[model samples]
Target chain A: MNADQLADVVAGVSDPEIDVGLRDLGVLRSVSLTDGRIRVHLTPTRLSCPAVGEIARRVRAALAEAAPGHGIEVVWERGAWQPAAVTAAGRDALRRGGYRVAGTAPRCPYCDSEDVEQAGRFGGAVCKVPYDCRGCGSTFDVIGTAGCNAMLPTPVRGGSR
Target chain B: MPHIPTDSDVYEVFAQSGHGTALSHVGSIVSPRPDAAWHLAKETYGRRDDLVKLWVVRRTDMIVSSAGDRDLLAAKTRMPYRQPGFPTARRRDRSAAPPAVAAPPERRDSGLTERRDDAREPRLTDLWLALADDLFVLGNRLGERIVDYIDLEEALAVGSIGQEALAHAGTILVLCGFDQPAVDARFFDRAQAQWQVSRVVERLTDWPSLVAGGLVIAAAVAVLAERTAEAEPGAEWLSAISAIRDEQLVHLDHWRRWARALAAWPETRTEFARAYAEVTECAGDMFGARPQSQGQGVPAAAPPAGPALAVTLHERLAVLVGDNGGPGSRLPDGPRTRTWGVGGSALADSLSRGRAIRDHYAPGVFS
Candidate 1:
């Protein structure tokens, strides 16, 4: 019905890991509409995160209802997502949701207990890692963004010894 | 043993405000403060007014987690097949462990090659081989010797060491961008090429030999892992190896405890030393034991100083293995009795074969 209201629809897409919306999480970089086509730019907290595809899908679905017959494209650029973009509320929500911002033991999202132990770093899923909450004796998944050793000491393919 | 960080990082001061109330935690704040604790409680739990007590605990204090008064980190995971008196490796289904988080595929071999082009020296391939091969061969031998133990605890320890060794080998393989089967085919399939590993297995077959081997291997790995952690504390390569290293240090402690236990018996200690003397020369080569020349096939390693870690590991391993009151106890055992005959011709052939491995790898080059 209106230009500004139609443009704000994709902002409602929430990050799967954290329950906060894209706009609130500061991942939604910019959204502009032109000639029945909407271009949305989003950024990821981690480059290797697999949730990028899911978030894009949610953006498309959210936009389909408001801007019918309009082509909506969600694009992500590396280095676009900044920690400063995350709102105060988003950070608080993440803490409340049992995820630590800095690399420390996270509180239990379920029991809200700080007595949580990291079970292992090799969390099988790309987005979430495995952690055991000792307080309630329950195991849960949290955002797994710890291992970022991108510049590995590469080996040259040499003949067998 | 539970891991204690070499340095204390932070203190999470909790102002209980009251006795029965909870303690609050925060990031590194070295100052004595009821005020900061007050703010943390207010921000995190919104319960500042309910406190009249305070507990300033060191960060490492929380690091030591306890389960029934025992350090949970030191607790041995009793693997069923690893249980003592188990006769064969075939009966034991090697468990599925936490898989390695390899660096992105594109960057795996390419990074080392690019770095090699700029710096024309062998990268730490020798160290990598030593670590990888030690883990692989030790794990295989340990698994094979599982029947030697009669006690449940000792057996479990043996199994745990072997299993963990295999798991670590996988990560080391991934990090080196080498295939496990390929490595197995290269070293494991052929006995002659296994100069570093065979020295241990060739002379010693009993459980005490396993203990001695376990002692040296675990100690070496622990030292290397600690050094690696210091070098790349927050790196991705460090990430996979670091986690494995933490637990491996526990395995090291477990083997040390076993070694200490075996040392209590004089007969067992003698057997251990007998086994030690056999593999002593090639012990340094445990990291990069291959006697072959480092041709163009080898990639350039940063900080190229022939296997410094190996030398350090060997020296540290000596201190550990020598602690059993056996003062200069590394008594030489006679000509290595082989599956083949112990005749003069056989002995002469074996001596030359062994010398080649020693000469190729170079004994004191690590320093």
Candidate 2:
């Protein structure tokens, strides 16, 4: 398959933790078909990402099934992954799933209170951050993994506050 | 199979300020349940200091753009005022504000008190905690759904969704001011010890949709080694079992680390850990029982006792600095700069003071 098509395939892989696609979530970095073989590179949000092997295996198997005896070489690129905002389209899908996308300020996912604040770096899983809300005065976790914070790419220097 | 449209969830997050400022949104939380959504929002958004509140909802409730539609870029025929194109410098400046009062400094907290008193009334820390919690839960959810794929395109979509969930969650966490201790440290130590799995999904070709599908089964085996051992399954099911095991392992690691850190401090650690565990339970139930209560969906109020880590840290710093008199008084009163010998003194002092105030009223909560 072509690189773009291959990338689409890689992006479709689901994360066991959050149950979303890689492309929409911003995990799969690059997918290339080189020298009669397909290579996929990805960064995990956390250091010891639990789903890496699973993700790779799934990708390989999917490609093989789709191409029928296609030689696929899925490579795990080294880098700490950080979470990224989904494309506008992805956001739409999430909205359909009964979620509210942040418009002005990023809102909390727990109490619907705007009085929420960040809590910890690590969420229960690799791709998330724990937060707390004041209106409800409670804490919860958010999804994150695969970009600057995760260590794969040097995020825009000093981009996030 | 008929195409089932996905639903979007809305997550509300806020930020807290030390000087009594209303919490503001840092990011969002994604979840099917309002209670679980909000709890996750708080943890993800408010892991740092001075947090106050969190909010979350389903994307379906929020009005937004969709994936299939290309209308976002449709050109406006008339009414230039309504269009959101580039604006002249002067117009841009004027549009942003009345153009009378000078822009406030980025880090300045000038009208904090007034803002706190405003109808919005959210603390800075609360906003952050909620965002963080939202992201964490969303990430976990992504893990649950992304595993065991059918084809390349689907796999890519799964990874994309998972990554997006994580990114939003991270934005909330950072903006809210939570600190990550070990960048490379996995969330769960014990889980990691048992399983060595990766979080990146790489789909090359088309497979199937079910977790029991062949592609998913292979992925599961490669990713979830430990869980495979725990589940007695035939070789045919190895892939699927492994996929779940791997995802759980990674997820467990993250939770374990988070729990341990929240519990590492003095008084609040236990409560923090306990509350956090309840909020993001693996089984989505009781910590030790079958009928677990995740604060009934909304975040349970801060345990009667808050985290004592701040208090203990404060007390320890007080004793240490008190004995040494700390840095011989050369530190400046502005934002602390150095982490060197005397530089750390200010941080210690600040921690001590805040802890003292919080603990004075609550006692054992921090003492």
Candidate 3:
């Protein structure tokens, strides 16, 4: 299989917790075929992310099925993964799944109201923070900046805070 | 009347979703007491269906390293040996396996020869060993009293911190060229006098004493780790020391929080103050001046000077207890002259107690 086809296969693997494809989540760092060996690099949302092993396993299994008898190496790159890495598609997928992406002014997922206050800096998972909506009287988790200060609202990219 | 501030501190909450999952920082809450912090954390972060366990630590207790410290975290050279995926990657690419361990610098011989005239001077290896052994002893010491804490949450926190200390000690041992067996031997078989743990760690008698002594020693270790990293640039162990220092900062914060909490209440304040004074009395040598640099010949870096470490510790203690004739008013204004080193009996006793417990449960498994 060509590099593009292999990339497509690997990208199809979704994060088990969020139910979003690795490509959309911007975790699939890169895919390249050099000397007939396919190399795929993944960057985790957090260094201590529990889903990393599962994600890597799924990527490996998918790639192996797509490109039979080919050398597949999945490398985990070490660095901080930012909320800005999330693709627009990833954001939409998360919103549809009742989650809001951080790095933007978080709105209530249920009512889409801007009147939201931080209930907790932490949420159900490491990458999420809980926000309470005044309009809907409901609490929703935002896929916030991993391992960064969740207390402050992350300024939107290329925009004033 | 003493002005007791009513404002609560922010406590960061970490939670484990399942039995085997790693605890992740889920969020934070504002609370006055550790118990109240835990309850607020549960309400805030534990609304989820997956929550299994929780740990609430004061946010201010965290010692965050500055941006300049990032260089210490960065790998100046590629260290494929440390990476878990390196072997598989090497096999897939038909490349050779990287060396399992990097050789530590040969500063010991030079350090000794240069300081031959000054027989009292410790070699760089000796200082490093002292730091590691101290942590090992402190960690096991904390483990012995985990069940003796006032509450289950405090016990759990103490247990977690103890495990962290032990882990940090193990990392330092690896940097000192110890393989797994050597590391195990160092923990289980080292003779008592050979241990270089500070006297403060050996003197922990109760919960208040542990909190006070741990605060002092954790701060000292953080200072020593920073000084060691600064002294030995480009060394293979720099990264390990950096990581240890980072965690040591957290441990320092944890202890500081407990000290402040205990001191805030009128009932516990006196007890904590007495414990702090006792620990501080023997903790003098921990911040002793750097052995006067053996003139010109020593190639090894001098261990961190005592005054610099003492200044920082005094400042932290002053903050914990107000400077206005508060609990720590009796804190020494300058580094004390007395030398500090626990006798081998302290370590021997600790080991015997640990062994007794092990033997009680498993019946000679440790034997």
Candidate 4:
């Protein structure tokens, strides 16, 4: 199968934490095909995401139908997850899930409070930040993981705060 | 979410915006029972009239109070009141008579919290750089301790954390507008005299204390990162901070797991306690620090900035170690605060001694 078609297959794999596929969450950093091997580099929303193994397994499971008998090795890459990596569709998914995405300020996932503030660093895990919604005064976790915070190549411009 | 759909039976409403996207929740509608809920929800939230589908779920089914089981919910609720952003609203309009009503800094539950106004982000950027310096040093120390790993897993985990830390430190250095050589000069080559990291960093005689100490330090940094991210100056660093925080999540988990595993043994508690004592001052200095230090160098006093991180390291350490005392309750009961200064172990030592000396000479230094 062509890389685009194969990518679509792996992209369909759902993120266990958030209800979006790897492609939308932007964790699917790259997918390439060479010499009868399918190489997928996935960025875990967090460094120690417990679902790393599970996500890889699911990617393998999904790829079976599309690229049967191909070598699929999921390599977790360096760019720590960033919200900017999230596609527009992924953002809609987050908003629909009651998580608000405002500029640098973390919007409340539970209350959609635009007036949010940081509650703590370790939001239960590495890829999450504990944020308190000023509107509801309730603290909830926001997905802090995305592609690397470094500015992307100008052409691939998907900048998010 | 009980408590969420309080007045009536809360039915969650999901709507399809168009084709392609899955049905997402628009809003909720309250009704006497489940049947009438969807109809009311449609009328309430479907006013846009573009929805192709809708689904109402009993709010009870969607109640996720977080991954924390019944036990941790209480402690989790008591997170310190410091708002985690390098709040831009404060920076955008600095006039004492702000035309717009800004978000109140500490409205949560009368906790002594850091207000958004006090997080002078540009100044705090400097603090973050200082933090990067501290982390670089600690990461180096942690890297050295990789040899003390109980197993491959421990070594791998600690080694990964150390590497991530150094990388984060590099990012912060870059963010501080430093060139590579300057970063190398400040972080790698020279000693940040003010980085009085809690002596516990050096005192990590065993694995448990090391993990415990790292946990407290990470928590303090996490809080700082959150606050900084909320600020205007911190916009560029948000993604980096978030990514770094993700590593912290791993660090916290590994350390907590390590500490907890050791807790089964008797000596680990003492070790944990020792870590707490050693790191507590460093943690305090790291957050609500006074400008002076154990080093003879003078501290530059900015406007009386609130403790960047209002949470007490002692309390956070207590909870992490399973003492579960609940935020330094057993310690002197008062508003959460510390003498604001650069974070480090030596700073912790200097601060403690400084507090004593300051009180001795000035008598009312605290008062």
Candidate 5:
């Protein structure tokens, strides 16, 4: 397979948890043919994330099948995965799947109501926070911005939206 | 008479929205007591947020670092090796064929190996072992008591703090040139008498005692780690040590907050004070001289002096329990001067318990 075909095969792998393609999720940092071998670099969402090992394994298996007899290497890059790295298409896909991406203003996922209150700074996962909607009377988890510094005190309106 | 809450009674509120999630700082509330603070936190934050757990610690109980100490609490340079991905990246690099062109020659002597004026001081290995063992022992003891905590939030916090201590211990062992298997053996199979842990960590019998004793030892360790990091700027492990010291500060803050909270309450006040006194009694010798092995002539380096470390510990303890007109005011002064060493039966018991758990799981064997 050519470089483009090889890249496509590598990008086909999806994150087990998020169910998004590696390329769309910004996990596929780079894919290049170096020294006649296929080398793929990936950056994890978090250093201690359990999905990293599985992702690497899947990537290796996918590449081996796509480009037979070619040596394949999956290199994990040393750096934090930034939420900003999410492609626009990836964001849209995530939203369609009922997942909120960080940096966007938080609203009720259920009713799309702007009148929301933060019920908890932490959610089921480290990257998410639980928010309650005054409109729908339901709580939903929103993917929080990457770091604690991003957690500014969001203003809450007294009246209905 | 019921005490009226005031601005001076500000409490920092932390909340967890789901089971097994860590509590994060949300905001602050002003209340006279912990119970009152919890109620106010729910009233203030629960209206909009869906909080399942909350922690209300008084602002006064926090140990804030000064602006000058920023470097001590953070890594000044990138430490790629510290990241989980580093080993994989390194392995890939090694497996790749060597570059066609020859690589540049390595430096003859990095500044790390150069002898300094304080060369006569004790080796970093000995100091690291002492610090690592202390944390390892404390981590095990704290972990053992996690299930005993009635409150889920407290139990989670204890488990997290314990895990952090163990991680720090492992990092220190790595710095001392021990691989993963070596670290496991040193942690689980080492003889009881060989442990260099301070006496303060060994006698934690109950919740109140754990809080008080943890506060004292955490303070001492934080101070010692900071001093070591400052003294050894050229050390290769500087960044790692700084990172560990930063987490040590967090541990210190947790213990400080709990110690103060327990002392302020009517129910736990007397018990907390008694635990504090008992721990401090034997804590004096915590910073004493490192004992030399038999027939080993001169010690490599002198341990941080007992009085100096004791003075720092005293000052910090004072900040926690000193001027407060509550039950803490009645507690004894900081650790007195004495020789402290590893516990005998306490160490044996803890080690045995750890071995039992390890055997039951039989690590490396899949069920």
Candidate 6:
């Protein structure tokens, strides 16, 4: 497949747990064709994240669905993981869907209220901390550091040279 | 139609305590609909003491580790030292004691202490003991009551009582820290009823006398069964009591088995008898003290050659003993006495009354 097609195919790997596109949680850093195989560089929200396996499997599945018989391998790196740095493209989609984009103060994902309070360290997911929007009176979880908690980053693997 | 989340769907539940605090894993919950899932999450995870807020997320959306490496965080080695075996155990004792004591002093001992590694063994043992004793006593009572009677109603009543007692005993055993998932229904079918009776037994402080009386009757029946085999060989009446004794023995053995749980829950003693009584009532109308009008009014005379005399004698004895308000009857020209004592003046009156009943019935048969 062409590099552009592969990029889109790679981008299709969403966060395995949230079902949100990888481009949204910002883990899809880059997609390039090095040698014969396609390489996708990926980072999770945390290094010791629990959902890394699931994320990797979903990525493989997405790739296979896009291009049947496509060989995929996932290499997860702990560094370059930041919940705040979700990509612009991904951020726009998440924002359009009424989810607060990563980075900046996490406004209540539910009400988009900046006037929020920390409800608890634990949220709906392992890495997400629940926050209450003072303005909207709703509670939502902010994805916390990955590899550190249950939340893992978007799935990506290096191309076979 | 709202979609119900299958087990595969994972929801990220977030609990908020107050403001700006981090949420921790209180627990996990499963459900179908997002809204319904949220409620289920709250019930299962939030019902516990730790949780205040809950979040539900479909599992499909969440990222997770592979099944192969799920135990990476699991403690592989003994970390006793991390909790209590530190080298500075002495030094920390001085510095940490006051603050540890100060932080939620009420909770320090009652809550955290319960979770500590040290207290669990003793606490579990205490619970086990209480459960065992409670079941054991109840089992003894049940075994003594089980009897197969000639009359269908009486047999059914006895069977129900036995079943209820065993049920209570079995559950008590299971709950006494035994990890069994289910109880043998044959052993204790009417446990709820037995528990009610147990409550009453606990309240009646004079229960020892009643229990002792029951035990004595059981023993006497056992003796009579043994004698039946030896004397008047193959007498059906004696065999009947023997069969009843066998059932009673089984009940006793089962109780012996479950005594551990009974000992664990001492507080339950007060309520068990009352529960048992309620259960018994549900099983059937109790055979409790029926007015003389209701019981078999001295069954009609049997043929002369039949062993009716002995049966009539016993029935008469039972009626006479039952009459005079349980052993305090004034016999003509005889000394007044309590009825239960062996060979007491009351016994003489009972014997005479029984003989009179036999003669009176025998003439009717002849006539």
Q: In TM-score terms, which candidate is top?
A: 5
Per-candidate interface DockQ score: 0.02, 0.02, 0.03, 0.04, 0.02, 0.01
Candidates' lDDT values, in order? Answer: 0.51, 0.39, 0.62, 0.54, 0.61, 0.40
**lDDT, model 1, position B202:** 42
Model 4, position A18: C-alpha lDDT score: 71
lDDT score at residue B2, model 5, on the 0-100 scale: 23
i-RMS for every candidate: 13.1, 13.1, 9.2, 11.0, 8.4, 31.5
| lDDT by residue (tens digit), candidate 3, A23-110 | 8887887899999798998876643355776888898898878777778787765333557788889888888888887677889888
For each candidate in turn, give its C-alpha RMSD to the true structure in angstroms: 23.8, 30.2, 23.5, 24.7, 24.3, 35.4
Model 3 chain A: weakest 10-residue lDDT segment is: A152-161
Residue B221 shift from truth in candidate 3, angstroms:
1.1
Question: On residues B132-246, what C-alpha lDDT tens digit does candidate 1 reach at each position?
Answer: 5556656766665555555544555566566667766655655565554444333323333222342443433445565666666676666666666565454545545554555
Tens digit of per-residue lDDT, candidate 2, span B1-367: 2233355555556666445776566787666667677678667776676455444445555555556556654665764433445234434543464312222222322221111222322222232232223233334334434434333333343454345435433433332332332111111111111111111111111111111111222222222233223334444323322333334333333333333443455764545533332222211100011111111211122121112322332233223222222122121222111110111221222223333454467544421
Give the higher-lDDT candidate: 3 or 4: 3
Off-target runs (Cα >4 Å) in candidate 4 are: A1-161, B1-122, B192-202, B289-304, B307-367
Candidate 2 local Cα displacement, residue B295, angstroms:
50
**TM-score on B-chain, cand. 6:** 0.22
Judged by DockQ cut-offs, the docking class of candidate 1 is incorrect
Residue range B29-69, candidate 5, lDDT tens digits: 77877768788888898878688888888876776566577
Off by over 4 Å in 1: A1-161, B1-123, B147-150, B180-184, B187-191, B194-198, B230-234, B266-269, B276-284, B287-301, B307-313, B320-367
lDDT of 6 by residue, A1-161 (tens): 87678767767777766656776677776666655555676765643245766777777777777766655656553335566567666666655554553345667655566776655332343345445677878765566542222232221111110
What is the CA-based DockQ of model 6? 0.01
Candidate 4 residue-wise lDDT, B261-320, digit = tens: 554457666655555455443343444333321111011222223432334433443444
lDDT of 3 by residue, B1-367 (tens): 2232333487878999998889888877788787788878787777766687788877666765555676776778876644677545644553352321222223212222222223354444444555566667677777766544444445555665676677667666655566656665566554443345666655665667777767766766676676666675776445456555655665676676677777788889888888878777666545442232222211145553344555664455444433221356344665553222353444555655554464477644433
Highest lDDT model number: 3
